[model samples]
Target: MSDAQSLWHLADGRALTLAGAAEARRLAVSRGRVWLTLSGTTDRPAEDCWLEAGEAVALAPGQTAVLEGWPAAEFELLVPPCSAAPGRGGLLGRRLFGG
Candidate 1:
């Protein structure tokens, strides 16, 4: 998960959950569509969304997300090159999801 970007494929009806995120990241759809659910924080309400191909969402620190493919999908999870740090969570620490 340390790479700048990682590609993942989700089968129809399959789901992926990203939790305990330590840094900000982006999830972009490369092919097909996805359904996304983001956990709420003290400052904001929880959200549910649908993303089509070429769409993207920003995930905040200390949040979590649940994603499901709509008839199969390909996507990428990306992190900024400057965001990684020593002793910090490597993509699975404090997490913020959605936006």
Candidate 2:
């Protein structure tokens, strides 16, 4: 895992929407469960599903996803290293480099 892979926590019953990403993303649940709605495009139909801990979904660049925490959840939005911003350092980097 890369240092840029940060974790997100959501309380049960809470929901969040992710959209307009510059690049594709992989949403992975680390703990608990989540309900997700993936917006449809001309070529693909919209999708609704449940993701348990250790499951993941691949989201396109322009796709939209609505995620609701199921009895609380923790997840990570994984972006490709090539897609990450250059010269940007994250928490792990800051801790390791002491910068």
Best by TM-score: 2
Candidate 2 regions exceeding 4 Å error are 87-99
Q: How far is candidate 2 from the true structure (C-alpha RMSD, Å)?
A: 5.2
Cα misplacement distance, residue 69 of candidate 2 (Å): 1.2
Residues 5-91, candidate 1, lDDT per residue (tens digit)?
A: 889999999999988488888999999999999888777789999999999998888779899999999999888755756435544
Which residue window of length 10 is worst by lDDT in model 2?
A: 90-99
Q: Give lDDT tens digits, candidate 2, residues 2-98.
A: 6358799989899999885878789999999999999986778999999999999988888899999889999998886656675565666556555
Q: Pick out the ten consecutive residues of candidate 1 with the lowest summed lDDT.
A: 90-99
TM-score of each: 0.79, 0.80
Task: Count clashing residue pairs in model 1.
Answer: 10
lDDT score, candidate 1, position 71: 92
Show the colliding residue pairs in model 2.
none
